[model samples]
Target: MDTCYLCGGLLELLGTLGRLAHYRCIDCGMEHSAGIDNDPTPTKERTDNDTDMENQGTSDSNHD
Candidate 1:
């Protein structure tokens, strides 16, 4: 698990593509890159999980 540079807390994986890693600070909602060291192998598709998450519930703006 990566750590956030801004908050000094464990980072949560937000998204990624190719060798680039995207992370967010769970505590502060800040997005940043996770340094590329042992780049993971390529996978089939991206954004599928994101779509699932979005479709599963109403967005924050839609809530009353």
Candidate 2:
């Protein structure tokens, strides 16, 4: 049985095409592809506007 790298849950084999095997996590329901170097963890790139918004929110809360 294969385990999911992100959630460590049981992985179910959906199907295979050529040399690639697809899998789906039963616990998290996340789909994964075998024989590939794909990262499942999501990431967001922070911009200057995002930082400014966070600072504004912090200052607004302090004013009250």
Best by TM-score: 2
TM-score of each: 0.50, 0.54
- Candidate 1 residues 1-64, lDDT tens each? 7666667667777677776787766776667764467522323344688788868856567535
Assess each prediction's global lDDT (C-alpha) against the native. Answer: 0.63, 0.70
Which pairs clash in model 2? none
Residue 53 accuracy (lDDT) in model 2: 86
Candidate 1, residue 21: Cα displacement in angstroms equals 0.6
lDDT of 2 by residue, 1-64 (tens): 6778878998887887776777888998778776544433322446899888887845444534
